[model samples]
Target: MPVPPPPADLTTIAHALQERLGPARWFDAHTHIGQHDPDGMTATAEEILAGLDHAGHERALTFAMHEPDGYRQANDVVLEASRASDGRLLPLARIAPGAPGALEEARRCLDAGALGFKLHPRSDAFALTHPDVDAVVALAAERRGPVLFHAGRGIPQLSEAAVALAERHPGARLILAHAAVSDLGLLAEPAARLPNLFFDTSWWHPSDLLQLFATVPPGQILYASDMPYGPGTFSAFAFLRCCAAVGIPDDAVREMVGAQLDRVVTGADPVDLGRAVGSARLGERSLPLERVASYTAVAMQLGYRGVDATEAVALARCGAQTTGTGPEAELLRYVDGLLARAEERLAAAADDDAPARMAAVLDAVVAGFLAATTSAGVPPVAL
Candidate 1:
């Protein structure tokens, strides 16, 4: 089957910028390939590879989903699968910080050829300050590897512990996944001092990402898709749109795509993309995109909360009815089409409760944010 091109408006935008930026090898800094997630999300290595092909990404940093039973077997599954991917997949062992033998398992996986580690404070039911966590992170520092944390949700005390851990282990590349939304303001402040600390762009909303891009060093922001939960192509489109919104230089955006990750995976220090310009003075807004952004936020919130978003989607379409004719409005038109398609998909789905239908809704939400970003072409600060 032919791989579909990215959404047309986004593709058009990339084409226009390619002249100055040239092409970049995008690396998805966060992803998963496993079947035993308690949350009912499963993704195969094949699916991730296909997603990479579709998104024009060159490689990915993949690990297992949450393994409540034990991560030893799941870690092996990831290592074995990544071994066969011919460099397209770089394996990261998932460690449950509270689990017994957690430090041993981290060592075992790294010795078994895994590149880094992933820890989920929310799912693993442990905090970063756990006694065993320092041991694992210390091992990562010794090996000069990455230790990616799930910062997707707000967890109590995680921010302070994470800052302390980064300060302690400058050798380990500590990546706070999902835009580090839990403590973007606080973390962004000290991120400049902690050269080893980083953030990955993997969350679903634009508001969080806007602040991340605005307030964090571009060098410290790695492009991530959080595959299985978020499709690679869709997330990549959002990345491109956000990059354009901030008006960063072509070279810096190129680095964010993959080049920077190439270094991070090896546990090497990141190349400087300069300091962030404070988020307080972020410039530009499009009324049309503003409507779409509001709709997107509400829709994602409802969907994730297990609420039906049909009424919200319908109400959103009402506001998008009159976007005039420019680049921003043009993207809004694309967003409107995606929303209509989502409605049609929802209507036609055999099982209304199926994951596909839920994914359809998310697709439109992400597209809405992508469109919203088109208006802020001259991002207030360069870094």
Candidate 2:
């Protein structure tokens, strides 16, 4: 299946929606500032800032990536970046719980101005139940700081392990990165049971976010891009799509986007910022809608046809409802029409290759829409 170009009117509607949302302040709760992996994942503070700027995020809680020396140097770099960022960047010291002097290192970083700490059990090769991890959690609890754990689809750092750890230190604010990635459903009960446990939106699947929003209290969820490692722009879009799909209230959306995290870090009351509507501001940031449209156009030009584009169209229509206006209703109908056409094309297509190709194109279009809406620079197309 080839990707079809989005209609010009569709692009215009997307832009209009972007403009209506206005400039939102996003605080990415999970981001890394250093490169320490064999997969060539590396980002400097400058690059991290650039990504943040592109995404219209005002601040991020960043930490060092995995390092060979127990993140000693990486922690220093994060501290330095945070010091120089004028509060735009908040440092979260990374610690290998099993390493010697880990607790002391965490204390030093906290005293040096780190707002929280991050632990990656998978990368550090330690279980969450380790005594060292307990010690780190204890320290964070004593200081009333947040601890972000890399809990996803794995043995040692699964959502269950995270729940057990959170249970031990009920006072500590523990964030489960990637929304517990593959185990959102399993963690829903624990998420509700543990008040100090929070989840971040960083995974690519919009469904996961939708489930999280639907199953968990809105206040317990935080907006995060996992920038410099994950697709920051796309992650933001996925979050938006989730909110739209779930019909999350505007005030709740605001809190999930940044306010909740702000309160956690600053101990301030969650301000009730009104809905993001009306005309856009001059020079305000926007997602890369044109790039997405162009990519879709190129895919269609290549003779691709599939149901994936139809699904994306449906998702966009759902997103239109978030605005709750007549114009948005009309836009939804327009997108529905496009979806019907795409479905017809998909039904008529005979080639088996169309599904995969169309899926890739739809994914790109969604990512592009996300980037365009938020004025976050578009990431390179995977296809």
Top candidate when judged by TM-score against the true structure: 1
Model 2, 114-152: lDDT tens digits are 887899887788987788888888888777788998866
Cα lDDT for residue 324, candidate 2: 45
When superposed on Cα atoms, how far off is each prediction in RMSD? 4.4, 10.5
Off by over 4 Å in 2: 1-19, 155-157, 267-383
TM-score of 1: 0.89
lDDT of 1 by residue, 145-240 (tens): 899999977677767988899999988899999998888878877888898888999987888888888888889999998887766766776776
Error of 2 at 287 (Å): 28
Kindly report which residue stretches of model 1 are placed more than 4 angstroms away from their true locations once superposed: 1-21, 277-282, 304-307, 323-334, 353-355, 374-383
State every prediction's TM-score relative to the real structure. 0.89, 0.69
